[model samples]
Target: MNKPDPIPARLAALKTTPTPDLKQQWRDLFDSEPPPFNRRYLESRLAYRIQELAYGGLKPETIRRLERLGEELDGGDRSKRSVRLDRDRPITGTRLLREWQGVEQIVTVTADGFEWQGRPYKSLSAIARAITGTRWNGWVFFGLKNHRGRT
Candidate 1:
């Protein structure tokens, strides 16, 4: 099941604001120089901060649980970083599947990149966008990242 966003309407409205306005909004909310990220990133982080201030941040227990999960996912050495995982970290030899436009899509993981329909892709996001005709975080589209935890 998916958890509902705490401030859906406000988040939805943020998408329409101008870029300059978004930068100002980020400064207003975070009280610091905003990271040089795109509008989508800015809006998403600002929305999170807004909700965090209003309804309180994530519960301590939830944070601990996520931390433990992260360690487990990283093979118990959380400090050791995998250079290949700087972005999407699909396990090699794993098969990724998705359904788009009522069709099942298949992708195979390789050491260098993801393979889709005999073609090699640099990133899963590229494959996902190719399949869907829209920008998508390949991990999220392939169910590797849960929808409920997006915000």
Candidate 2:
């Protein structure tokens, strides 16, 4: 039988086999040229990832960071961190019986009173009782109200 080609020569040739350029392969996979490495882009991408994680049910700290990122993107001024709550003034009376629109349990305060659409109560607990037909949870009603006190 003919002697096999030298193993060393075969191994050397195999080693020299043209290797596909990874960069070009990646560009082809993406169907576009790769974007230049940018610190700002990386940061924004990271921020978006963090926001998704937070909204997907991460811890409060993570949500806070995501919110900060959103505020930064919106050009929000962070120096003014104080929220003024005029608790000394009473709720006085109801303004208009509006309704809660969004999924989040939000109580919108107008010039008159609070209005929640999805909420069980109409005029607070009385409405709540009228709906649920029992005491149920009065605190839920009160909590939705803008009482005269510091929040």
Among the numbered candidates, top lDDT falls to 1
Q: What is the Cα root-mean-square deviation between model 2 and the actual structure?
A: 22.5
lDDT of each: 0.76, 0.41
Prediction 2 TM-score vs. true: 0.22
Q: How close is every model to the real structure, measured as TM-score?
A: 0.48, 0.22
- The runs of at least 3 residues in candidate 1 whose Cα sits more than 4 Å from the true structure, single-residue gaps closed, are 1-9, 81-151
10 residues in a row with least lDDT, candidate 2:
95-104
Which whole-number lDDT from 0 to 100 does residue 127 have in model 1?
Answer: 94
Q: Candidate 2, residues 62-143: lDDT per residue as tens digits?
A: 8899889968876676544333333322254432222122212333444444455534333455544544557734334433
Global CA lDDT computed for model 2? 0.41
Against the true structure, what is every candidate's RMSD? 10.2, 22.5
In TM-score terms, candidate 1 sits at 0.48
